[model samples]
Target: MRLEGKVALISGGAHGVEGEMMGFGGASARLFVQEGAKVVLGDIAVEDGEKTASQLRDAGYDALFVKLDVTNEQDWENAVRTAVTNFGRLDIMVNNAGTGGPGNVEETTEDIWDGQMDVHAKGVFLGTKHAIPEMRKVGGGSIINISSIYGLVGSVGSTAYHAAKGAIRIFSKSAAVQYASENIRVNSVHPGFITTPLTREGLKNPEREQFMLDRIPMGRIGDPDEIAKGIVYLASDESSYMTGSELVIDGGMTAQ
Candidate 1:
């Protein structure tokens, strides 16, 4: 029960995408629930979000589902309000909703670029903006921004995606510095190519999968649970002194 009595609101926390199951949000949601946090699963995917909350409830955890459009300020406000109304306070905020970017600078359209910024950059900003007050009400809290290894290192394609993630990475540090004295810890988690619906299409090609695997010194990608564990640590008192830190769980990809 590392997160016992904590209230968490996770963006893009629906349990499934297309036919694949669970991304970083869903995985972290489960871990939060297991560790005794009352969770609000926030996502635009209403059905799946409810399903996930229902499953957690069935397993005897305190959970709720909220319809959240991360790109919308009103939606973020509602989600935060709902979590506080029901759970009394918010302790953890996970900005884990995002899409994979596969386009280059020239190939990327304005819409594509805007979408990435809105969802990744703007979404995170909104989440942190709204979540801070609720966290302060509880005396202090933690915010986990989901970034990517691509955010740390420049890559070949997906210029917009990289840009948005890079935005999140730095944004987290800024928030951490701003709120450290208030006991509000803000940190970013950078995952290398994790197995999730977002990467399903790319991994479909065995060649591409192998090419990615070859680059990782560990000879494999990551799992959502692995990243979730790090989140749990940040959200818990175990990392009480840590703030403005970047947790990189990329199977040794970045070390090289």
Candidate 2:
């Protein structure tokens, strides 16, 4: 009941580390719904997104699915419109849609770099821009930007991904400072290597998985639910005094 009576919009909810049972966005959305929050689940994967929404609806939770290409401004507008029209207001905006960009600087192409930037950095910019006015009307709200542990440190073979995530970290902080007076709290959540479809290929190789685990002080990859819990905290009033901050849920990866 942490988010009781709130309204949430979660992007990239179709699938990821949380699995069919629990994608990060999907898990967070479900958690919010269970806590009495109406959720707008958005993603480029229309089929999966719709399914997730239907499941929530079947459970008697208020939920809706919207096909969202985060890079498109019109998509953002339509998403906000749908949420406002259906739910009356938007209380939380989670910019969770992102991609793992090309892994090495030398191997990265211009297209890869641009695509990563468009989805991660530019997408967050657009989501916040459109969500802010609506949040203002409600007097205040929360914005959770999903970043990565790579944002805080250099990762081999993930130049563009690291750069985009790093940008989101600072961008969220700046937005938080600028909007604090308006009662809008902005924060970034940085997660370490989590067991998701995106990282499954690497995880399949025991050596690679062990390499990742060895770096984490906790000796494990984080669970999507763990990250979802952090998202809920930021989305709810529990984080009222927190803004312009980065919450790292990396299993102590960044600590080492």
Q: Estimate every model's Cα lDDT from 0 to 1.
A: 0.90, 0.89
Residue 212, candidate 2: Cα error in Å is 0.5
Tell me the lDDT of model 1 at 8: 94
Model 2 clashing-pair count: 3
Per-residue error (Å), model 1, residue 157: 0.4
> For model 1, how does the per-residue alpha-carbon lDDT over 1-256 read when each residue is reduced to its tens digit?
8888899999989973324567888888889988989999899889888988888888898889999999999999999999999999999999998987678899999999999999999999999999999888889999999988988998779899999999999999999999988999999989888888678778899998998999899998788788888888988999999988889999999898
lDDT of 1: 0.90
Instruction: For each candidate, give its TM-score against the true structure.
Output: 0.97, 0.97
